[model samples]
Target: MTQRHDIRLGADIGGTFTDIALDVRGRLFSTKVLTDYAAPEQAILDGIDIVIRDAGIAPGDIGIVIHGTTLATNALIERRGAKTALVTTEGFRDVIEMRTENRFEQYDLDLVLPRPLIPREDRFAVRGRIDAQGRELQPLDEAALEVLADVIAERGFGAVAIGFIHSYMNPAHEQRARDILAGRLSIPISISAEVSPQMREFERFNTVCANAYVRPQMADYLSRLQVRLKEMGAGCPVFMIHSGGGLISVETASEFPVRLVESGPAGGAIFAADIARRFGLERVVSYDMGGTTAKICLIEDYQPHTARTFEVARTYRFCKGSGMPISIPVIEMIEIGAGGGSIAWVDAMGRIQAGPESAASEPGPACYQRGGERPAITDADLVLGKLDPDNFAGGKIRLSLDNAGAAIARDVGDRLALSPEAAAFGIVEVVDENMANAARVHAVENGKNISENTMIAFGGAAPLHAARLCEKLGVERCLVPQGAGVGSAIGFLKAPFGYEALASKIMGLSKFDAGTVNAMLDDLKATAEGFVRAGTDGAIVREITAFMRYAGQGWEIPVTLPDRAFAAADTAMFETAFKQRYARFFGRAVEGPEIEFVTWSVKAQDVRPEGERFVLETDGAAVAVPARRGVFDPASGTVLETAIVPRDTLCPGARVAGPAVIVERETSTVVTSPFDAVIQVDGTILLVRKGR
Candidate 1:
């Protein structure tokens, strides 16, 4: 009864690689190619070509194509976007510069925060003002805007951002400014009223600026990709994944490109949730380590945790509140600059230091021998004999062990007076610890204890490092899902066509206006449904979310409304629900304090198919045999002969005493002494405590 014409394709473009997947009736096929930063769409086409050929399906058979990429995020971080300008209220031209004045690191007297994207000269203020109660205090000046438009035209800015103070509460002034600019210039304009209608001026302004900054670039790329796909005989609808784990129309993505900053990682979270659902896992931590970055996220009850805002390119790789924050619904996660291509070096203290910077794929690590002379994490893994040089990347790219040794010896061994092997071990250990530290911090911040949660590791580099991370985080089990190397791309196949719309309105619960609130909710619901319908074929949409809050809660918590709209009788119900969620999070809802709704969000999603459950193995065991290899264990402080086993040879329920290595095709797992390892029913390696 099933037709082959309904195949779905998904792709995730990262800094180092582009992963592609095709799913036909729940069966999946995937492939990977080096990301062509110069022309990213070329990489997508190449990978798609391979996958479709492998699946033996015609391009026209594809019904839908879903994509997630870090192109916007990379453009923001690397400052490689369109030349853009910002328009704001006359008195608040520097709001982006005057970010929240709190120092995330208080003890350091001199701390450097991230610089605002818009420079002082590019920030021009238009005459306008709005109150917190959706009232326009001063009308937007038309004559002033005419002069500003000429100035912008002279500068030839590609895009413009308008973020008047309190515009979130009252968008009239911002909308008027946008209209003036639209007529005067041929460039796209982003208004804070729609981009981030939240009470926080700093976050709202940043979001608008980011959207403007990347709009031109995203538009160009998506247009070209559409043309290319059509030429390839593919007539499928193209949808882009948003940071909130939902698919949006390509047009929407181009308009608000900032929403795509965490798009790739969001897909990985969705993939982990799918795996968790298949096995009935209640709590899981998804770990995805690629070549340039490692991302960690928490999933509770098969849903990735979501946040109203996310930071990009933190100066301190693992520190929160140290980067630019954009107000968008994103899957909450922590990312560190520790990954496969992270450079390894000896610091002034003669200790090994792994990165917050990457060599990337061009020259890549020393083992790649693509003209790179620097030692890197991948090089270290090769030096330790953990990676098969000839079999790297399924032998698509050969590795050079000599090049790795030479780079490590010259850069690290010479300074530390240690052998290359020892230096490689040091780099590996430090990077693993950095990843573990990030995991620990993210868990604590989210009120989670990782010891009880199963670790689902994916991406090309994760399985290689999962066991070590588990040891550091005190986790007992690790699962490498099928097609783990291209996990995020696979995740795109599991996401629903969805979109979220938010607006800022100052409303007090004590004096709630039901009619006004109902109208606003109705507008947002329709907006979300319009987006979902554009990319999906007559799929039904489901609405979900909640209010965001503080302790007396002058600001309200983002509360999830029931499936129905606000009823005249439900005002009290809304208040009660808000109070209960507030108390549950903070332990107490202060009495007699008024609560205000800062923002309201409405999300619309298309229902997806249920995944089949796979059984766990308890009786079948892995045939364990240990081959010896010299490895430097930090705990022992010396090189020792360690036992190694082939990962595939191990059957479910097979136990291996640790101080062992489990090698697979793409990656390896290391089990240290005092921790015993077993193959779980789902083909994942479970390392648990044993009587040593």
Candidate 2:
């Protein structure tokens, strides 16, 4: 039996900063470092060393490491990945190019669609046919595959993605193609049936192609990182957080790299959900504003919203159907390119716009003084007196106010004929409104109300803007939890060792087959449990979901089923569940319409970690502040004097009236004039509307 060590590690690699947290016997130690564009692993190693030193422990004391990164996402967006090829069914060469054929920008005549990840030149088609119902028509041609392998090897392709039509129903053809290709080609092969085995051909194909495109790169990186960690004397096994907020072994992650695309943001969602559960809040909005992007996820009943499919790298930031669709289980959220490093500038239409682009870490915000000339959100925050120049990043990196002022003045102030102070204020308000709108849209789409939810904010920049975001959305309360700066890393530490397996097998309640359903579910449960066993020797929990829909409906909704074996009588239970979920989404269910099941999912995990529950109450006392500073307020369009309070000095139930700044090591909280800040029982800063 393996021993459970007291020390564990969690690392989150954001676009601008790589956050690391070490949980030693429940006490946390964390640090933030600039992301190394050339070598991401080097940054992690460096930060790990620093954090271990700070915790006064040796590297060998750590038992496990859980990591989450945006590398796959950034690679897809920036078009940086290994040379990849696609092998598809004959006569379907243009399916990826002619995506769903929907115009995201319908009104614009000259709309630009995003370029497909696999170019036509690299895509190869094979002569094989599998009918939609698992029937074999034309067998896979090995001769054609052999020739294609020769051509692929000649072209020096690093990876190959095999996605035959209807492979999800019968993976025999795809598996045969992989075996044949392996004999002649020395490269990684990704099949749609294994990566994303759902029904939609376009989505399954695209997802497998993406996985192959980044397989070699991610595998090499993970291998090198593990080797380096062992050399440094920390030889503990490392796990990765998947996009669905579950931990998988690094080997599994390397094979299914696409699952890691939104992994970092998923950790943030898990963190918010954990906070919501601790506070006993039912409805909450997770606000994670980091260096490169801001992610907003809605949580109800301590669960983050999940979706079977999500888009990646949207070409039009505000438009749907403008990006590559990947078929997988993921935590659903709205991620916009608005963060502390989001560049601000005047657009050609004589209007100011904050990013859907970012400065990242290399030439971060102008306030960092690292050769950045473009004005960014951090620069605006500095100009607005929201950040302490000398105490930024726990005084590790001093900010340059002059650089921020010059950059903003040259880029935005000159264009608008306004001072840099006014431009900075405009930048902040615009970004805040952008985040607010994203939250609103996400909530509305999910059939939820944003104003009725409490905002749980975290990340390096979330605390700074969370209160204002709540104010814009008409929210009553917002909580900046303990260690908000490295919240995602902390989230990783709290994640359960788990895996989910999905199978697409069409079935209907009218002709329910209990034996077949039980067999399929049993297989999925075994597969999921096998993965979870890699991390622990403990009792595990299982959950199953069935994707169901009315007959002739294009989309399906998830209806959770009991973990036990399905019996003949359970058909009525399934029907009732389907009807209830359908009513919740569409407001009504037709009595005569036939309902069919599309897919099945099984998730197994070690029991979730529990936290000590506590109640938050107010003591009705005020903490005295020592000094004040001039801060910019867009509500009044002028600078005002604001109190500066140290975060550690505040006791439970102590309150401070805004405008005020709560300063901490990793981040700062900006309490707007209309809100008052109070310290909760768990050292969480709760900001509330003045009259609420």
Candidate 3:
């Protein structure tokens, strides 16, 4: 027997919309509201009110609240975080600015780089020296930190970040500096030893600085949100989803806000993985396209790929090393500024450019008619007749076709010497190509071929272009799951309470130190379990991975370790594991090279529920069509009559041919000529190529 008292709520705030989902026992209710940048929590509150009301539940009945947001990522990209100061080891104040000294783009002589978050004037160094082996060569200068605290206070800094050299090996210096500074200054402090605790001084330092930069803002917002929720009678325990696709206590989220950078997209990836698992699918591609960006992630064996480090706000969208790297557990994916509100234009070379930029929600696409004059992807879709002007957002928002055409004519059509319809088609095609290129690159990087993987498309704009994306990628099938528009929010509701802890200590396989390594792993495992226990008393599963590399190699590949204690005799097993994992990428490993372990990670999470298999009700009678409309056909470069069918009217196994529009309350899916759609038992719209 199930109790109705276990009510859970989820909120996901993206670049454009704030989605809210309420799981009352087993039934789910959701709503979407435009994100209010000025007071982002207001949108969450508004959406929450709607969903809980529609669910026929009072706020007091909600026992848990889970949230994920893109505010940290946006602030880092826009350089709008709090006034921050950084404390570093003596003579290394510029390590973040220096970066790794490797040029990702070798040919560009005048390439610009991302600016460091903390400027030189605000970065102060204390006399402290710690060796890579955790030896304190020079004691931290307490008096110098006192002076630096005055300087920080004089500059009115809201937060301070401490990143001493070799802190990942030993954090004593950073911890002392933080204590001394805390005694003198009244501001939040973030230490690399606590935030990242990983090797690589530059990435570790920048990550702490980033965590400090956004800590104040996130703390304030979270505080107010708690108060508002309490007022609304939903004063339950509030948790946050991190970029690693794990739930954490709000306290942890406020302390290391940088972990939330890719939180929203992480949820989307989790959603796709859950969908794949529900249908027993193995190879899956998760595509999430919202108003401001699109994210592509690969899922294998019912899990989204995980990364120990990821870049944020890349100057070059596809360039690997062009952004600020943060060492943290994160969902591996590629994000591009190609989405519904991506502005379309003709670049200097007269080539059509979609974007690494967006209009966002406020002053959104021109067709939104909220003061935007630029042509965006949504406007192009409208001009191309793919979107309904009068029935947009379930008639909640009335789109303007005139605005869409005018903006397209001015920005793209005129420059290309083409009609608005032609320009719309071109814009849509260009954006589609951009997304496809991202997908292809991501696939190759992951040693995958997308032609064999099924695409799970979601978010507000994904289904709108998913069919075409499939065509471009040569993917035979794409599934737009139920509540696709609020997919990430729904994912949050289903996510497990988990956390990851990392530690770095260089060791060789020849002298395997199992005792020392096991001690470290024990501490990390306990840390992860503490976080998971904060959410529930369910059984916890633990996974350990080591970053191993051939001695003298610049990088290491993650190797999953088998559960149980390691012994001296396990050295051969270690070598075999490294070679096998290495061969998967480089075709073969270099034999006889000394192997070393650089970093170790431990993840702990609750056991996930197994989804029940469902069969489509194919025996149902034929469903009725809702309406009919004219949609632009890119194949013919002209408007063609399209059947407008309400998604509710399409029950399980209901089939609809191409050149149709399936309308739902949140978003619409355009079934192109090359594909046909069938409704699954779980309300997923499965689009398969015709005659396949």
Candidate 4:
């Protein structure tokens, strides 16, 4: 095992900012910088240098570095990945195009479904047939792989994804094809059996195709990042955070890069979960609004709820089936194209709308003077006095109020016949409402209530808009954790080193075969252990899981297996537990039909994160006030003078009322008309709805 004294680092790259954190004995230091999407590694190195300096440590003293990024997500959204191809069994070339057959907008006949990741021309099929029971009905032809490899290479493709029929049940054929294609092409390969070992050919195949599409780009960037870190005298073992709220080695991340799609937002969810645990809160909603997007995730009972599938790079706003599906264990959340940098525009109907298109960092906003002419949410916030022009990004970058107001006035105000300030408020309110609507839909779909969940707000822009969001959701309280500006980076430290392995197999409880179940479980254990061994050196690991199902009738809810593998004698116990879980999810369980298991999952995790907790110093009380600022309030329908209080001045138990501003070095949290906040024991400010 590695020594406990080694220092660990974590970095998260977002659309608007790149965040970095250093954890030495569980004490975290962090920093945020503008993301360099053109050369993403540069921002990573810069943030690393800042964080290492903040920790007062030499770069060479660092031991392990874990990174999380939205790069793959962004690349898919912006269409910047390598040209890729998908090879599948004959007659299944249109599987991705066919999709789920459910229309996102059932009423609109003209609605265009999202385009497939691989075009029709890029899709090739081979002759092979595997049945549902892992039986090969038609033998795989060895000659086809060579022909496909030549055609794939001739097209100058960078990566290829192979997803044959029933590969999830038996991967032998896919493995054979991969071996045959190894020497014929230099491109990377992704097999559905390894990427998503589940039923549903459309989703599994899409997941593998997405992974292959982004592998080459992710690998090249990671290699350059490693070299740059070493050049700066840091010889740390780099780690990457996966979307499942766990950490894995960078080498594993480079191979299966699709898992990193929601990696940044996943880190934020972990941070929120940790905060919930510390404060003893049972239900919390993590709100992370960075430069280009805002993410909302629900955490309950000190852990975030995870999903087996996620959609990436959706074309339409708030549409679920509008994106390609990736089958992996992910901390389920809802994301929207509403953030500080989301561009605002006046539509043909003259209705002002905030984005699903971001200006990004290079040409951030009109206020940044980086050649951006479009009006953005941040520009509007500055125009309405919600943001301090001089204190933006800890005063590292100055905002131009004239440019912001002028852009909003010319772009939106002129069309709506309103003043720039009114237009700016409209933009802010519309974006907030968009985010609020997304949150409500997500919660409703997951069989949850938004009002019952506590809101944990982070990211550079979240603190500024969190109180408003809480009001919109009817949430009683909100938590703004310390270092909220670089929330995802801090979240990286809170994550555990782990991996999830899954497989789909048919099993009927009526004729339950203990041997088959045990064998399948063993195979899953071996796969998880193989990944863990590559990342950690003899670390203690535990396997846990549940069987997936629909309630009652023919399916069973996920019943957790015992620590040891299943035995023939335990079949009755398993059935009893499944009945209880089924009743819990749905009101009751049916007694007549036989229960079936569609798929099973196994997750391996370390005993703890890479360090021991260190005691932190708590602040006493502040003795001074900053100043006052007049801010426009929509609730009041006018501008009012509001007191500005620095966050550092408030101590634990100190209370602040609404119509006040709590400013910090990195960002500000606004206490609005009906909200009041009190500092908690752990230095987190808890904002609760108050009776005025």
Q: Report the C-alpha displacement of residue 645, candidate 3, in angstroms.
A: 0.4
Alpha-carbon lDDT, every model? 0.83, 0.91, 0.89, 0.83
Off by over 4 Å in 1: 1-5, 538-541, 548-556, 624-666, 669-692
Judging by TM-score against the true structure, name the best candidate: 2
| 571: Cα error in model 2, Å | 2.0
Ordered from best to worst lDDT, the candidate numbers read 2, 3, 4, 1
lDDT of 1 by residue, 1-692 (tens): 11122588999998778889899776777877888988999999998888888888888989888999999998999998889899998988888998988788888788997889999999998777787777878888989998889999999899999998887767888888888888999999999988888778898999999999999999999999999999999887788999999989889999989989999999999999998898788999999999889999999999998888889988876677899898998999999888898888877887788887788887789888788999989998888766778777767789999999999999998888889887888888899998988988898887778788989998888877787788788887677776788899989988888888877776666667778877888888898888887865655666556564533444455677787656568767777777788776678776676666657778888778786886543233445475778755544666667777877677667877767777764456666664667777666666565642
Quote each prediction's TM-score: 0.94, 0.99, 0.98, 0.95
Between prediction 1 and prediction 4, which has the larger TM-score?
4
Over 322-396, each residue of candidate 4 has an lDDT whose tens digit, in order, gives: 887888989999999988899999888888899889988979999998998889999988887878888887788
TM-score of 2: 0.99
- Candidates 1 and 3 compared by TM-score, better number: 3
Q: Which prediction has more favorable lDDT, 1 or 4?
A: 4
In model 3, which regions exceed 4 Å deviation?
A: 1-5, 615-624
lDDT, residue 680, model 3: 87
Q: Which candidate is the best by lDDT?
A: 2
Q: Model 3, range 305-415, lDDT digits (tens) per residue? A: 999899998998799889999889999999999989899999999988997778888899999989999999999999877788887776778999999999999998999
Considering TM-score, where higher is better, how would the candidates rank from best to worst? 2, 3, 4, 1
Positional deviation of residue 207's Cα in model 3 after best superposition, in angstroms: 0.5
Better of 2 and 3 by TM-score: 2
